[model samples]
Target: MTRRTMVFLAGFVAVAIFILGSIFYTKPAPDFAQGIGPGGDSVLVRPHSPILGPETANVTVTEFFDPMCETCREFFPLVEEIIGDHQGKVRVVLRYATFHPGSEDAVRILEAARRQNKFESVLFVLLEKQSEWAAHGEPNIARAWELAGEAGLDLPKAKTDALSPEVDRVIQQDLADAKSAGVSKTPTFFVNGKPLLSFGKQQLYDMVLAEVGQ
Candidate 1:
């Protein structure tokens, strides 16, 4: 069962919960297929969105993820591998779809981590210990802070920055875009703005591979 297919089959149960909803390097400016990407008036790739790989890479994958979603955590390394496989040919654009309980605060922590240049560290830590802090029915918000601190984030500054209006703006933009883009699930994706017509790990891989060839 592909991740997307699995998500599709199980989505309703997850959605019944009333959800919610990374970067490697700089981009090099790869040519994008017209119309689907975050160009013109689109808002997926906002100013504060952390990007990995070169902007110039030919393939860009935009994912709407929830920091608290277990599925998102499962797929993180896969996404990392895809980008790594493509080297500078692929770039990832991450957006929020904060549906899970306590997810908003988690995202706030990530945004703050970005400010402190600890995004990669904090994100991995949170995901690594997701079950501990993001427990399904009872989110341990304080534990998340401790995990972030363990991830090398400067906790005091992270807390202050996480609550900033600027970070709020980042979250707000993602919320608006998620609605406008019709994204109702976490880890929803687009390749250079083109929706993933079908979902699967291989399908996801092929999408970017095809883009790389272009």
Candidate 2:
């Protein structure tokens, strides 16, 4: 082939491979069911599982989240809305997966709040203000303390608890659990122990409904 023709052929081949690789990489993996057993050693830290909703609810939606993940923040409101709408019909279980380095501090702060029985409230506020705090050049522990205060947790105690061995164990357990689940991304979720294939709220709702036989 002429030099010009050879160059054109090579470029075309490169483009084809790139396109094929992109398609393969983005394709969803098959839906596989992991039977519901005890949380056991599979998770780094064992959260309050089957977190009680309506005792009669047939479906369980479990979320594995990182506090510093922007996408998780974006999805938080929607998830909360869904839980509210399905009240008594859906059980939502939250698992900490500190995927980002900054997430460690956030996770510890949350666990500290949990020690004070304020975990849910503090976690919600943290998710709401994640952008403001995480965007800062340094991890803002003070801001986290302020949020804890706002959530009705004693700031001093929360700060002290954040450094405690229990909080450290919780963080370590969460990380280990994330690894066991083969989760590498923030906001990973499971509906009835089956992985969610899409990221949108609508997809999440649909999957939950399907599992719930709604």
What overall lDDT goes with each candidate model? 0.82, 0.72
TM-scores of all predicted structures: 0.80, 0.74
Cα lDDT tens digits for candidate 2, 43-131:
42244432435534556666788788888888877777767877767766677887676778888788787788888888888878776
Most lDDT-accurate candidate: 1
In the range 26-77, model 1's lDDT, one tens digit per residue, is 5443332343333423555665677766766767788999989988998898
Candidate 2: misplaced stretches above 4 Å? 1-57
Q: Which runs in model 1 stand beyond 4 Å of their true positions? A: 1-41
What residue pairs are clashing in model 2? 44-173, 44-177, 45-173
